[model samples]
Target: MHSEVAQLFRYSLGFIAAISFVACLCIIALAQVFPWLCGRRDDENAVQSMHSRPTPRIGGVAIFFTLALGVVFAPTTIVQSYLGVIIATTLLFLVGLSEDLGFRVSPRRRLLAVCVASLVVIVLLGVWLPRISMPYFDLLMQYWIVGVPFTLLITAGVANGFNLIDGVNGLAALTAIGASVSIALISLQAGYDTMAMVSMMLAAVIFGFFLVNFPFGIIFLGDAGAYTIGFVLSWFGIAVLIDSSQVSAWAILLTLFWPLADTVFAIYRRSRSKKDAMAPDRLHFHQLVMRGLEICILGRKRRRIANPLTTLVLAPFVIAPQVCGVLLWDHNRAAFFTVLAFLAVFIASYLVAVPAIRACRQRPQEA
Candidate 1:
C-alpha cells in the first residue's frame, strides 16, 4: 500500500512538471505572436532604447495565461488552498499590463494595488505563518497581527525588487530563477506539496523566459513579467514559511536575503538623501556591475572576457553565500545570526569594492 501510494505521488508530480514545461513553451510562442496580432508593435519601440534591439516586452501575458491554465488543471486540493495565488497573480498581471501600456500610474497607486493583492492571498486565502520563533522565546504569538503587515510588505517588496533589478539583461531573470529554485527546494524538503508545485511551475516558466532574456537578449520580462514573477515568488516564500513544520521562520529570511537586503538598503539610501523613498535610481549593485562592464567593453579590451567576467565573477561571490547559509542552518536563531553576519560582510565588501572599481575607471586614458 505504501509503495503504491509513493509511486502514484511521483507520477502525479512528473505529470505536473511535464505540463509546466509545455505551458512555458506555449506561452513564449504566444508572447511572440500576440503583438503582431493585436496591432501593438509600436510598444516594442519603447523598449528598443533600453535594450540593444527591439524585443517583445509583453511576455508576462503568456506566463500568466499559462499559469492560470495550470492552476485550472491542478488537483482540487492544491487549487483550493492556492486559490489566492491564482487570483493575486492575475491582479498583478493586469496591473503590470496597465503600466506597460504607458499608463502613468504613480508609485502610491502601484503600492496600493500590491497591498490589495497581498491581502487577498494572506488574509482572505488564510495563507499566513501561525508562529514565529524569537531569539529566546520558542514560539512567539501575535502572528495574526504581525503576519498581515509582514505579508503585505514582503509581497509588495518582492514585486518591486524584481522590477527595480530589471535594468540589465539576464540579471532580474537570473535572480528570479535562483529564487524560484530555492523556494521549490525548500518547500519540497518541508513537505509542502502545493507550494512546491507552484514554485516548480514558476521556475520552469522563468527558465523559458530566460532562454530569450539572457546573452542573446531576445525579449524583456517588462513590468508584467516582473510583477507576476515577484508576486508568485513572494507568496510561495510566505506559504513555505507559514505552512512548513520542518522549516523555521528564519530560514525564510535567509532564502530571500538578497532582495530583502537590497530593498531595505535602497529605502534607507533614498531616505538619507532626502529623496522620495520610491524614486528610481541606478545605484543598485547590478547597475554598478553594468557600469563596470560598459567601461571595460569601451576600453577596447576583449568583449568576450568582460561580459562573462562581470556576471560570473561577481554573482557567485555575492549570491552563493546567502544560499549556502539558508541550506546549512536549520535553527531559527542560528540562521538569523548567520544572515546578520553575512550582511555585515556584504556591506563591508561593497563599500571597499565600489570605490575601488570607480577609481579604476576614473583614471585618465593611457597616452
Candidate 2:
C-alpha cells in the first residue's frame, strides 16, 4: 500500500509539473508578442515599478488557468476533498487578475475579497487555526469563534504579503518557490503526500516563470501572480498544520518567513516615517539591497545586471529560515525559538544594510 501510494504521488507530481512547464513557456511567448493576451504593464505610477518598458504582468493568468486545468487531472478523491480550497484560490486569482489589467482596485476591497475567500475555506472546508504553538493562544484557538477570525486575519495578511514583496525581478517568485519547497518537505515528512505534491507543483510553475523573469526581466508576475501564489502557499501551509499535529506552527511560519518578515518591517518602517501604512515606496528591504548591488557590487558599468543579481545575492538569506524550519519541523518549542532567532538576524541585517545602501545611492556617479 505504501509503495502504491508513493508511485501515485510521483505520477501526480510529474503530470502537474509537465503541464505547468508548458503553460509557462506558452505564456512567456505570448507575453512578448500578444500585448492583450497578458495584461500590458506600463511602468507608471506603481510602487514596484523598476523597469522602463511595458511588459505583461499577467503571468498569474497563465499560472491560474494552467493550475485549474491541472486540477482536473488530480485524483477524484483529492479533488472532491479539496474542492473548497480550489474554489477560493480561483476567486482570489480573479481579484488579482482584474488589478493586473490596470483596474483601480481599492486596497480595502482587495483585502475584503481575500477575507471572503479565506472565510469560505474556513466555514465550508473546515480549515482553520487549530493551534498557534503558544499555550495561551492554543487554548483560546480551540474555540471556533476565536480560531476562525484569527485564521482569516493570517490568510489575508499572507495573501497581501506576496504583493508587498513583488518589487524586483525574481524576488517574489523565488521566495514563493522556497516557501513551497519547505511546505512540500515538511508535508512529506508528516506523511501527507497529496499536499506535498501540490506544493512541489507550485514550486515547479514558479521555477518555470522564474527563468524568463530573472536576469532578463522579460515578464513580471504582477498583482495576479503574487496574490495567487501567496494565497495558495499560505493556505497549503495551514492545511499541513491542520492535517498533522506533528507539524509545528513555527515551521509553517518559517516556510513563509521572508515575506512575513518583509511585510512586518515595511509596516514598521512606514509608521516610523509617519507615512500611511499602506503607502508604497521603493525603500523596501529588497529595493535597498538591489540599489547597493547596483552601485557597489555591480558597479556603474554593470548596473544593468543589478536587478536580477539582487535575487541571486539575497535568495540564500531568505531561504535559510525555511531550511532551519524544516530541520526543526518536529520540535515545536525549538522551531519557535529558531524562528525568532532567524527573524532577529534578518532584521539586524536589514537595518545595517539600509544605511550603507543609502550612502551608495548618494555617492557620485562613476562615469
In terms of TM-score, the best-performing candidate is 2
Each prediction's whole-model lDDT (CA) = 0.65, 0.79
| lDDT (Cα, tens digit) per residue for candidate 1, span 1-367 | 3353344346644554455445545645765666542224454344213343345566576567656766654546667656667787777778877776566566677777888888777656766545445643434334557767766777788788777766556667677767777776677666666566666667666766666556545556677878887877777776676676557666666666666667777888789999988887767765566556666444535333343345554566446644864485357667777778877876776677688667767776542
Candidate 2 ranges beyond 4 A from true positions: 1-15, 32-42, 73-76, 300-303, 362-367
lDDT of 2 by residue, 1-367 (tens): 3474466556765666566656766777876777664454444556666666667777786677766765665545567545677788878888887887777677677888888888878777766878888878788897988998888778877878898888778999889989998998898899887777667767877876776677777677877788888887888888898899999999999988888888888889889999987777888778877778877667755545877788888899889998988898889999988888987998899889987876777777543
Off by over 4 Å in 1: 1-52, 72-75, 135-143, 297-310, 317-322, 365-367
